[model samples]
Target: MGGGVLGTMHAWQAVLRGHEVIHLEREPEARGASVRNFGLVWVSGRADGEELETALRARELWAGLGERVPGLGFRANGSLTVLRTEAELAVAEVFAAGPDAAARGTRLVDPAEARTVNPALRGAFLGALWCERDAAVEPRVAQPALRAHLAATGRYTWLPGREVREVDARGVRDDHGDHHHADVVLLCTGAALSGLVREIAGPVPVRRVRLQMMQTEPLDEPLTTSVADGDSLRYYPAYRGVELDALNANQPQPAVAAEHAMQLLMVQRADGGLTVGDTHGYDEPFPFDVVEEPYQHLRQVAEAILGRPLPPVRRRWAGVYAQCRDTGQVVHRQRVADNAWLVTGPGGRGMTCSPAIAERTVEEIGL
Candidate 1:
């Protein structure tokens, strides 16, 4: 039973259902992709059908939960995928014209309208694709806030710095040789795929993805909505249209961006700083050091979009998360034992869909 967003969500689901919960974490707090992310409850770019449905439901649940837990700092800020070139705008138009575009709350806006939506976006973009369903929260405080709420219920116990070494159908034992019993056991480990996780899910069809990101000092202006560049079209599945194919064929990403598999996703934090990212690395044996080239490219692209210099760099880091290699599966979930379940490999969808995933798990187990 991990204590990342996924694990916390599972615990929240059970506690909401009136089940006494015992949450365990290996570290003093979650220091994984959950907190390293943009704290984005992104709904528009999810793959269609089941994935999209899950994202939508999760978005709704997040809003409701945010109200209950005020410290989440949830805001329905929406998002803008700004298009700089005619080719990128063409792809956005095609995506906007799709059958489910309206259902996804997607619309194409002219440059003027894009600026109107987010004044901080002073760059001269051709246009932008807007997704009103997108939202954000304070990732740095989300876990502790949720835990505080759960603790108030007098039915939740948080055991931090406890690494689960052994798990059985009945319960689990931590590294300190302590055994805890529970009627049901759920393992929501984010990216740690060793020991019990490996023993149960042998040679899992999951791979790790590494990414680098950086945050800036407080900005002079506010980024009302999260932002993404045209390069994001290659990363998100929702843009897999004929126009996207043409755009990809005709206009490729810049050398440095392509080499690092980079995308520009920027969001403003509660402190008025901006969280910007990121580049993807999927090969095994990820580099021990974060490369500077990706960060340089990101800063250059971000400055161009803002039409101003970025704030001084405040923090830089890298995060890795498990992703299902099989594209068909939303996440790798399996019943590893009689009363034990392993739910991991949500990839980047973890932050966006964890709430709904946990809700489904509770229903499936009749908790």
Candidate 2:
């Protein structure tokens, strides 16, 4: 049982199927990766095939949900992975000419065209890889908004502050010593993979990923579209190819950037502040804190792109998300019992693919 985006989306799907759902969460409110993200329905760099398909479907779902729940703040703003160097441009050119370009709504735009798409990018740039399929929603508010929509149907009950301690074929028992009966139990837990998850399915194949993220005060102007620096070409899978390999060989990140696995993904919030991030930390025993080096690097890159200094930093934080070790599996879904299942390890795709992931889980389980 969980109450994050994946779990909330599961509840939404079940209620849509005429099932009375009782969603449970350990915390009174979600204080995890779900809220601590860029709120990006990012489709620009998803690995092709299943991952990309799931993201496209989820983007559609989020758009539809936005119509029903205004608080979702869903927007088809798309994204511009700004490319400054010739190497980054080369990778984007290859991707723009790829077979999946049309499917991903991808295009390579010149500097003039890119500026038209997002005028806030006043800084110099070679070009940009634009993906019109990309979208965004307010991560901090999405779950509560979705839950409110589910509640409107009178088929959903949100039970936060109740951690499931036991699971069986019939139902689950909460930490408060209360048992709730159900026909089937879908454990959509996020990164808390120990305790009940371990008891039910043992150790999972997924690994916990930690990342550092931050938000700015407020930009005087609108960002218009989500933005990414050239470093993204190295991190996202869609750009993987010989061209990328050459680029990587010829242009490696600086020491601090390379050390932290850093990338610049900036999205403007509804309030005008920009949400920027992120550095990947895969090793276990992740630091329980944020470091200044990555943030400094991010600031330098972001300012270089915008040709202006960013507003004062208002918030800085670290979040941990579960990602499948076997990069091939979109998500790890395990049958823990006769009528119980465990689902998690969506990785960064959690926000972008949650709606579609939950939909697939329902179909597979015949829910």
lDDT of 2 by residue, 254-367 (tens): 999899898999999999999999999999999877889899999999999999999999999999999999976789999999999899999989999999999999999999
RMSD of candidate 1 to true structure, Å: 0.9
The regions of model 1 sitting more than 4 angstroms off are none
Model 1 C-alpha lDDT per residue in residues 33-57, reported as the tens digit of each score: 9899999999877789989999999
Candidate 1 lDDT score at position 89 = 92
**TM-score to true structure, per model:** 0.99, 0.99
- lDDT of candidate 1? 0.91
TM-score of 1: 0.99
